[model samples]
Target: MAEERTESKTTILIVDDSEINRDVLKEIFKDDYTILEADNGKAAIDMVVKSRAFLAAILLDINMPEMDGFAVLTEIGKVKLLDKIPVIMITSDTSAETERRCYEQGVADVICKPFEPLIVKQKVSRSIELILSKRHLEEQITSQTKLLRAQYQQLQKQQEILKKNNALIVEKICTIVEFRNLESGYHLRRIHDFVSILGRYIMNMYPEYGLTQYQVDVMADASAMHDIGKITVPDTILLKPGRLTRDEFEVMKSHTTRGCDIIRMLSDIQDKDYFEYSYDICRHHHEKYDGNGYPDGLKGEDISIAAQLTGLADVYDALISERVYKAAYSMDKAFGMIVNGECGVFNPKLINCFRQAKLEMNNAFLKTKMKEKEELKALHGEDDDYDDD
Candidate 1:
């Protein structure tokens, strides 16, 4: 028994109005526990608050001078220390109503004043064990909760890192395709910028697309790979100075499926949004809204929205760009051709957004022209004969 008391080092608080009752209880438990005595409820509350970390149980009396047992329980409840310390009610009254009130006030057990010494010790020991067990369980739950939260945050950070890396790899791969197709890197930049603008407008005006901001961002960047497969086309056809023959056009169209296959080889891209947007734009950017597109005649909404945004961006750039087959059309003519359906059918909703976004598009074009002039002036000196064409 002495060894057992030493192992646990239990502490007990006895609150009572009578010095005799306090003395009796202390005498009973003094051998087995570190006993704390309080003459009134206020003193007991103070003791419980001060020693809450070590105190195992509280022995409270129902009748006291200023604050009663119920009032003390209320005070303990205010500090939320009731569960940490098991309360046992000790009083002279043995009425059922009084016992019920004590139990309702969250006491561990109620004992009449003519209590047996052995019974008091047994009850207090059991209550102390119960409180200790509850505190142990609560501590375990708090520890586990903290651990899970940390793991979740770590997982989120790792996923974000992977996404950023995949995007960089895609951009680099697209740069290689630009070189192989004999186009400047500016083509990729302009396509990405144009599609981003269209995607933002569509997300704001069309709720049916269910497009999230993350999806929009991925789609914009993924558009850079729309011509990744043009790297596979023969130089004779890819660099043709005139319109392609029917056979040559057919060969050129195969780039769509070829680009998809090439993107699939990149095993590092694990994000579903990135993969889906990249694959869809690469394979279906040439698809028409009227189901007359090649490789697969997916019409209207059947073609992924990602493809639609990228396709329009491609068409706009190709019109304004001086390709081997044609001189650059003026901006007004290109806009008229797209809006008048000369550039194949397009989604009506996107068509409206295209109209609204044209002003911004022109502004971006002017900025590029200004940057080009700056570069030219740096190369040829500011006073050199410079043509604005």
Candidate 2:
């Protein structure tokens, strides 16, 4: 009475080579479920594909004339559309290798022949639940994939507009920040170059970090504004000839927070990856993993990864190159200091990555410098030629 109550609740497809076996099972499970019968694996697959109702579970017999269940499984596996359905292999073989192979082939369960009606009932119940779960997950992935592809297409269409606006926004901020030491704030250019270098390394090493060629370009473009908050600080503090007074230093430290906030207020940063990049450059750039840094004083992994990495790039550029108040150090000097753990300013993880991609990063730095020179010349109306050069 209970079995009849149960099979009535689920859709079951039973495959067997023997007509007698099919009759016996049908009689046993008749009251419990809506049962569909097939004489072999081929018929079971055909029934599954054509049925309007979704399959709750499949009982596949391994031994049969014409097509064995194993062969049917191989064919079923090849059909991508039907891959989510769970198949319970019904066979008397009981060998360890056979059992292992069934699991490796994605079979949900194995049932020995001369099966007790109760065991059949129990296995079917479990496998049906599993199959339904698998189908639900597959449906979720399919829906998500569709959503992603649509979003990607929309983004591609708006990409050119995004790039132009983003550039203009960053340029304005850059101009504001560097107006005092504008002659030397070329460090802004180098910082973008450094971000691209690290971005490429992260892409090659861990593509899962949301790194892409487009993202690299975006990082290079957005990184220009990392120091934009400095514009809000007083000229007295920014252009001071020596170390900042503690009060002045506090005001200076506010730049990181200020930069992030400024970027946040812009509509352009509302798009994809903007907040991620901004969050990194803004909040945690001054944080130390060991908890001794500035702004948030965040330590360890609590630091936003984007901020931590940008911190490393920012410090390296500061250490290696000329500033309004300092001369350029040789690459060897800067690199040695970086590797030796200078103060607590940098993320060691990023420093290690710098070593691995050192040659590439330096090359990118030179390219960025050249690009900056070109921009400067263009701004001054320096080049005139064959109307094209």
Candidate 3:
């Protein structure tokens, strides 16, 4: 249908030894198509394979020197191009075995010799039309493949931009959380480094989380904002050296809602999903197994998976790090308490993975702490900035 608009003409290849038959056939199709002639089977094969465009149907003659129609069909079968180009066997001897062999070798249609000029034209036209339709489908497939590839590349670049941009925002937010407690950047930095180590440990064990190197990089950068909710906690409660009183603790629990609100607002403006992702992790990371968490008491499986994972990192660091009121527990004691204290609280599957790869997790934890110390020293090399109250 589309061919009617352009210099769109199908090509008919006539393979015969006799020049008379070739000219006669050429004359038959001259008005409707652009005719191409091949005196031998090899030439027809070369023209079909090397040239770009569809060969409607090959009118292959049985009687020819060197390579006959059968040989050409066989050659085409050998190369697996029979599906693209339909072969119509033109033979004088309508032998049973020859016809069977052509069909066995995967031919489209077979025509007997002493050919009727009108019938020859009709058969060739029909076969060509079918073959050309198939070729058009292939062209469409190639076009779609190229389009999908381009879209995939563009999406990948945009995700990179989102990953880095979100990290900067999370860092800024976590600094706000850190200032609420100690006014130093240490708490945010330490938690992020600890979570990075935990993430790597989990990735090594369970790759189903899509925790590839690139993904972990994104997770680590985003991890800094895990406690961003603490920013909304009142200064009296946040800065209280003593344990939070009952009423003060209730107010403290509202920080998660306030954090979610702020991030949700930012997500609305950015038209992005990364902040929402961090939002879930930040808001629900405190949830326990039996629905004891404040803000939204989502228990166990009800909690976001990202938040559950962040909880592991946050609690692990809290147990190990030296605090103002309580001394840090030893790693062995801390691990035992984490595993036994809450049932169905920490993801059992995650706990199992951590238990199995305990040594690796320990090594990662130590390495992360060391790395953070080095980084902190490099950032502030004994600067004389001190809190003189």
TM-score of each: 0.75, 0.56, 0.78
- Candidate 2, residue 108: CA error in Å? 27
Write model 2 residue lDDT over 1-389, tens digit each, in one string. Answer: 85454444766778998888788777767887777889977787788776425566678888898898888788778874335666888888989998998888888888887878888878877877776778789899999999999999998879867767677776776676657566435777777778777877777876556667887777777677677788788888887768788999999999888877787788445555665676567666788878998787888878865666677778777776656457667766877777777746555656667789778767766676677667767866765542312
Q: In model 1, what lDDT does residue 304 have?
A: 91
lDDT score, candidate 3: 0.70
Q: Per-residue lDDT of 40-68 in model 1, one digit per residue for the tens?
A: 98888888877777787889998898899
Error of 3 at 305 (Å): 1.6
Query: lDDT of each model, Cα atoms only?
Result: 0.85, 0.74, 0.70
The candidate, 2 or 3, that scores higher on lDDT is: 2
* Lowest lDDT 10-residue stretch of candidate 2: 380-389
How far does residue 378 in candidate 1 sit from its true spot (Å)? 6.9
Alpha-carbon runs more than 4 Å astray in model 3: 1-9, 17-31, 34-57, 73-86, 93-96, 103-107, 114-119, 178-222, 269-271, 342-344, 375-389
What clash pairs does model 1 have?
A: none
Question: 188 in model 2: Cα distance from truth in Å?
Answer: 2.2
Ranked candidates, highest TM-score first? 3, 1, 2
- Give the worst 10-residue stretch by lDDT in candidate 1: 177-186
